[model samples]
Target chain A: MKPKRTGKPEAAAVDRDHALHLLRAMTRIRRLEEKCAELYSAMKIRGFLHLYDGQEAVAVGVMQALTPEDAVVATYREHAHALIRGVSAGSILAEMYGKQEGCSRGRGGSMHLFDQETRFYGGNAIVGGGLPIAVGLALADKMQGRVRVTCCFFGEGAVAEGEFHESLNLAVLWQVPVLFVCENNLYAMGTALEFEHAVTDIARKAACYDLPSTAVDGMDVLAVETAAARAVAAVRAGEGPQFLECRTYRFRAHSMYDAELYRSKDEVRQWKKRGPIATFTQKMKRRGRLADADVKAIEGEVAREIEGAVAFAEACTWEPVEDATRFVYSEGRMP
Target chain B: MIDGEQALRTITYREAVREALREALQKDERVFLMGEDVGRYGGCFAVSKGLLEAFGPERIRDTPLSESGFVGAGIGAALGGMRPIVEVMTVNFSLLCADQIINNAAVYLYMSGGQFNVPLVIRLATGGGRQLAAQHSRSLEGWYAHIPGIKILSPATVEDARGMLWTALQDPDPVLIFENSGLYNMEATLGADAGPVDIHQARVRRAGRDISIITYSASLYKALEAAETLAKEGIEAEVIDLRTLRPLDERTFLESVARTHRALIVDEGWRSGGISAEIASRIMEGAFYELDAPVARLCSQEAPMPYAKHMEDAVLPQAAGIVDLVRHMVNAHG
Candidate 1:
């Protein structure tokens, strides 16, 4: 269901702790991404910094429904996903900093963060590349009789890739449990949705492959979480593949390099008014689940955390150039 | 010359490969064979003819005509802790999934900072000689060998055909085994207990002192034939079969070149930027001082493989051409 743009977040059923947890999650992503932009500007990070600015609700809500056992494959614009999936903020920043202490050991910069401990598959840079990987991960789980879901996140742009069609078909054909999440942030690089997809409705495209799909208001944290929980439960129950099209928008440019000539300031300003963090914060305050002091405390705590992460990243050491060729093949193996 | 206790059986190369797949599936529960027509259709070239009935459908899977999808799924399966043997019908079709093989399977371990290892094996029929024409016929193993993160294996003999698959599956990284379509029907004697073989070294198929005929896959047989013809004329040529193309056993061939004082590379792939070119360059870099004459290569003609038999034959490197090249190198050097 489309979220009401004017009403308070339907918070009547949400308890205090859960409401605050969701608020903190969104706040953490927002603060972390804001810092990442500053770092990119300061030249502390380089090579295509895609901040997950206006879409915090999607990652925050979806992650709330996933277990640690589930695998996640996300796009290059995945700093928020990685952070929400429990990759330490320090490691994520260090990865962008190209440090050996980074989660990907500095080998993968911004677009290739990977953490085996979290079962996070990668920060895949190619559009539509992670769909097949997620299918295969779920295929392995199904073959081995493991009850787990593999959540894959991509942009609406990936809907145009053949791998998307092939993966959905294979997922249902083989009956693997994978949740395909399309973060429809409207623009793929500089191209608009209409310019890329003939059908702007991304969820309907998943229906073509007989996949059960839902289009949730990506700006509403509760909406995304509800849809994701249902989808994840069905996938875990071996209901084959499920797809969620999160209708969202990116407040920042597509990348640090983009001028965003395809979009306008007016449109960006309108989306910002519906920004996930602000709307959710205002709704919780209105419901009396939070106060001005609570928001202030949360902001202060998140700010300190971001500072600590930045400090950790700044102190991390560079990987020795001698080890540059190390991971090309696994170490301690005959190449 | 055989030991009385050990029994040997004669089998076709196709049977040997099937035996390897059957052994791998039986040995490891995590091992499965996946590709188009690998199940009910019994493989494109019938290499996996009876596997589906033997191992059942789960282990012997048949995928749709989505090369990139299945191949990427193979990479994902490998990451998720299963040893997958993905087969593309031929090297020509592998292009559709080159992104998966080169980008995903190959770079996963490295890009992930060694957190994940893709224990995946890709098997595909390579080379031309069946008049499958340009679209179906290709010898692009050399192009794959150019990639760093994966290993390339060309099984020219029955023993290698029977043994390489299991060894490749054991590798922590991805390995692409190129089974030349031309050699699938060749028959040879192999021990009944024949199992996994080393995939790291070049094997000396024939020993001599005059020249080193370096080749692999189906071209190895042609080089051996040329060596036999040259041996009859009193010019003994050592034949080196490069079983592993990527991490090439340059030491074996370099040592052979040092003793023989001359080298001639025979490959089915085109000469320009092919494995032959890499081997020649390596020889020049490693054993140039030991050579009595400059190294030479006999590769397929720089053109698309034709459908007609005579035109195809004219394009490929034949035994006669190898013999003539060896004769000229030996005679002129002497």
Candidate 2:
């Protein structure tokens, strides 16, 4: 499939305030993830922590086009998605701490954060697991005649799973309104796209299902937002499902335990030069939209927010062992 | 066949199950049935015939042969506030979608820390009698019963076949209904107005004082036949049909064993690590003191089901095997 570049930004779309806001959102994820890595080393936040280091633009940008009424299904490395979807950083951090006050009540450590109020379906750990759920959510909306979109986010690794093909076929067949956002970050864990897939054009796979698809520069927050807004509008207007392959990279290892044995350090350094946060900041400065003082102030504010979130997580009470067996089956709604 | 002046109606097990689906769709606007060939194809076993015209494609949805995808979609639909009844053609085919059934549907409620509960019902035909071979015929209800978060129901009777769907739809968590394929052609008289049945308890099909023959699904009929043959031999046998496999009604069989002072479990599933072993263990745990003889179990032979008819019949738990086991137990205890 051809990469859609019509919505590509040639100039600043917003003034100083909006750019800084987006910058802060991406930086919040960066800071929180950095703290998470530190905490992992300190033996505090235990469990598989898949950090969303370089791919912040994808989550922040795509989520901007969604409303609270819309549903979201995300992969395990979804700290940014949960945060952008209005889940409190304290709750996300508290979940990592395994505290009951956290989102998901501490049951889902890092990979399974869920919030019913925001319609965040999960932090699904299984590769390609969320695609069907997203399609089903869209089916519910279509059957109910609700004008809403279900945006599903997964790694490019999911394209190889049978559920991906099945879900795409079902979504298009039923005319369900879903925006399938595939984060094609060039690697599936340690396997590069070239090594993993015979054809690395992930968006092209949707053509077989007759769904409209496009490839976008995932590192540019503005381009991702433009593509996502267009896709979300198409889905909301009773059009069939749309697929967006966000071409990006994860600067960190797959999880906290990776040794970075696959790719060379030079390649990592080259990608780091075009990191989403840095590239966006540079673009804003070049356009005379954001000042250096604004950048420092944004950084300071985000640092404080991360500190408060860490403190909140540290102080939150642990779930009582006696209540461990609850919620297996719903206890039914109270009358 | 008319049972009385109360207006009896006879229906096959397949029809009863279909009736249950129709009633569920008619009663609840939120409930819908989706499966491979559940629509125009009228279900693989012809159980859902005419439902496509009645409910239309919107509700009587047909799906591709993607078990995991559709099953996961059913769970997602349930979470999205829709009650979906997903039919897998058979229990053997359900293995393809077991991940979604086990991990997502069963684990979502607990994994999400009570934020979500999948109110989904999955119905699949199970058991062996025809020469459908190994993959086509499997009694995996026992395997599903091993899970913690989901409920398992084996509808052995026509009433249960007609009644279990509505109750299963009303459940707040995932529920699996295993219909024995061998019993689909079996017919029974139903009242014109039959409704939902409670899914939590076991029913005593026949009462006797000598020994308790506990079983479920298609095996219930075998146990009842064994009870009859034992009656002619001057040994009365109480028969208990366990409708709910999980959260098993240990009280019913335990009380029956207390009265008869003997217990024999007949399950169509394999003997080792199967549902019979669980019931036997429960019997030993709860009713050991009251037993006049050691609890005996007659399960399917430990092997993959062969294709031949006689071999398949021999591999399953049958009436003759039940009679032989019960006779030995009664003779030894007496």
Give the deviation of candidate 1 from the true structure as CA RMSD. 2.3
Q: In candidate 1, which residue ranges exceed 4 Å CA deviation? A: A1-10, A333-335, B1-6
For model 2, report DockQ. Answer: 0.66
Best by lDDT: 1
CAPRI-style class, candidate 2 = medium
Give stretches of model 2 more than 4 Å off: A1-7, A332-335, B1-6
Write out the backbone clash pairs for model 2. Answer: none
Question: Candidate 1's residue-wise lDDT over A1-335, tens digit each?
Answer: 22212233356788888888998889999999899899988999999989899999999989988999999999999988999999999999999999999999999999999999999998998888889899999999999999999999999999999999999999989989999999999999999999998988888888878888888899999889888888899998878888998999999999999988999999999999999989988887888888898888889999999999999999999988988788788778763
lDDT of 2 at A296: 99
Clashing pairs in model 1, backbone N/Cα/C closer than 3 A: none
